[model samples]
Target chain A: MAPQSPSSARAALFDVDGTLVDSNYLHVRAWQRAFREIGHDVDAWRVHRAIGLDSSLLLESLLGDDADSLGDRAKDLHMTYYLGARDSMRPLAGARELVRELHGRGVQVVLATSASEEELDVLREVLSVDSCIAHTTSAADVDRAKPDPGVIRAAMDRSSTSGETAVMVGDAVWDAEAASRAGVTFVGLLSGGISRAELEAAGAEAVFEDAQDLLDRLDSSPLARLLSL
Target chain B: MAPQSPSSARAALFDVDGTLVDSNYLHVRAWQRAFREIGHDVDAWRVHRAIGLDSSLLLESLLGDDADSLGDRAKDLHMTYYLGARDSMRPLAGARELVRELHGRGVQVVLATSASEEELDVLREVLSVDSCIAHTTSAADVDRAKPDPGVIRAAMDRSSTSGETAVMVGDAVWDAEAASRAGVTFVGLLSGGISRAELEAAGAEAVFEDAQDLLDRLDSSPLARLLSL
Candidate 1:
């Protein structure tokens, strides 16, 4: 590829599950069932709050000491239950349009997610805007999942952009913390059932109702400011 | 029943679904599926926020004009999906113990829910502390659901308790609003995935992590204050 100019190097990193797709609650339910199958009864709301963490980290967080002995089985059970519910997944309102709009504005769109390679494929299919996506990072790309900032840095590296030239959009506190740690601007969406207050407290510079709301207010949003930069 | 002394007439009205039972996310999923089946494709988080509303009102709020054409069918679909997932329902930590503790304290425990009589039966079974429950009010007992205050008032009346002598515990903003309107103190629970800020803003006088946390802090809680009144 030819060398790109600095202005043309701007990028937008996206979180998939709860940000662009309606799958957070499914993950919560699956994890709840998985914990139960392993003889640990975890609450759904607890799992919901823990959704953006990597599966192993989530199991460890919810199961504590029991995670060592039951983690692998619970992880496998979660995968089975989650995959069984995969057919129900759908893109959030304007998810495809928002990504396409960002790409059309000359901003590279990178999917920065901790989802496994197989799960990423399904999510990409659901999003159906692969043509607009310039780069993607998955669990395979990083040693640590979100709230660790490794995945955000990896996505920025893959997109050939610096944190200053990119903005991260997600629906969970973990995503906000990760982006903040990576020195990137963070925008939050409430589509994940996390309240705006929680997201703002976690370091989101802007909060929207969902992909559609963000798209509707794109002109005044941080994404617009980043593009102007 | 014989007339009871005023001190023994203190009551606690409970919202069952997300407050005591770990079923809010299930309700969100079921509503999402129900809306999709009717071709609406509602977001899960939106359904989640609207969980405490009566089924008809929830449909109307989500579907708007489309609800006029699709309300009954969507309601039926939601019931079917929710009931199918009934076996997955479990009580939140200390749910049983909380009710029994209140009963042991001479506080009449009344389940004030907009859940159908049939659904309430299943929830009561999951809670398995019916003997500690002094009374219960369902959708059948009132023409309006939460945020209307009618159900809360009905529940208080059934328990022979005045607003000053009762407190409401729930996991939704609607519950807080209803309790506020009914002149009763409201205690919010985060087990419903609602943020503490949202609950407090909605008029919750106190907030707890869940039934367990409230039970752990009962001596300092509004429940104790009511008893002292």
Candidate 2:
């Protein structure tokens, strides 16, 4: 068989925090503050690497056996810190245009995140592109988070899309892992601050600089080809 | 941190079989043959998607618990069948030039693959760019194959390069996943027949249409920037 092209995609699943919004670094800071408040000091980059992971798995992957004892408290603390940090949250450049363009092209656009409903509301408020999204899957909708493939599956399911016709856009390794394991194509974006090499190694098919880069390349990008635009 | 540019790369780690040589389809066919000889039929894309996985993990991922019973037999069958399929193997377009170009640019080019020494010998013979590769790490050098990061680490170790100064180029998600976890930057090639989205999602900072496409853009490529040229 020849190399399969991007023409197979029909639905676009976007990982919100890092991919669409410039919140990954804030999440890293929040996690750090949360851990620090609990008398633990963790490296920022290590926290950055674990950004897209489900809160529980993120704690476990980073804390190892210690997670069992401290996960819940850290999660709560992080949430509190994040709520205050929300004011700094903003959609990445070209994010609104990219989503609106996908919608304009008749592609089903869905936001998939482990964020809670209230947090989702905040993000939606900032992006203000609610009308462009066809569906959304939040932490409450997914029993498991990324690296488990369950959230990706749930996101795809909500849009009635299959792996062959779906593409996941994320800024972290966890998002790529989820999309890869779920058999969906994963497109990586650098807007979230993840390195390209890290993103590629996680399983991105193609990567863009950010939402604007993707939007600018719509005519030449795999996403445009996938949408058959 | 901002999106990391590929300027940090000082050496290039290349995955041979599928990345440089056009052996990915042959792999899919071999697995299909081995599985079918056992009376089970799986999709070609399914087999293709699992190509870069370490052989042991490939079976476990594709066949689940049932692989525990049939793995040894399938392995034997695949080896037998692959020996015959080797005749069809060829280096991908510009594969040789890409290696030579990297070498000429003073970048340490190393071949990193899980292929056994014997299998790797066959691949090198066909690629015929032996002088371009500064180092090689076969399955013998690493206890864990790709997707485990050990092989990637071993290759980088031989060149005395750190993750920030190393880049991995391959055609599969497993290669990307391995590089991502190892903290190395990963560039992806489409010559292996994997989709761009899948490559990017797996964590490729960039994905070229093929080795030729990569060479064509070598002047402005991450590989060039990685070498500080």
lDDT tens digits, residue span B56-134, model 2: 8989886788798998888788877776767656677788998888877777888988888878888899899988788
DockQ versus reference, model 2 = 0.01
* Candidate closest to the true structure, highest lDDT: 1
Residue A85 lDDT, candidate 2, scale 0-100: 72
List the global CA lDDT of all models: 0.90, 0.79
Model 1: what TM-score?
0.97
**Candidate 2 lDDT for residue A208:** 88
Model 2, A130-190: lDDT tens per residue? Answer: 8888889888987888878888888888877787777889888888898889998888887
The total number of steric clashes, by the backbone 3 Å criterion, in model 2 comes to 28
True contacts kept of each: 0.83, 0.00
How many angstroms is residue A36 displaced in model 2 relative to the true structure, after the best TM-score fit? 0.8
Give TM per candidate: 0.97, 0.49
User: Which segments of model 2 are wrong by more than 4 Å?
Assistant: A1-9, B1-229
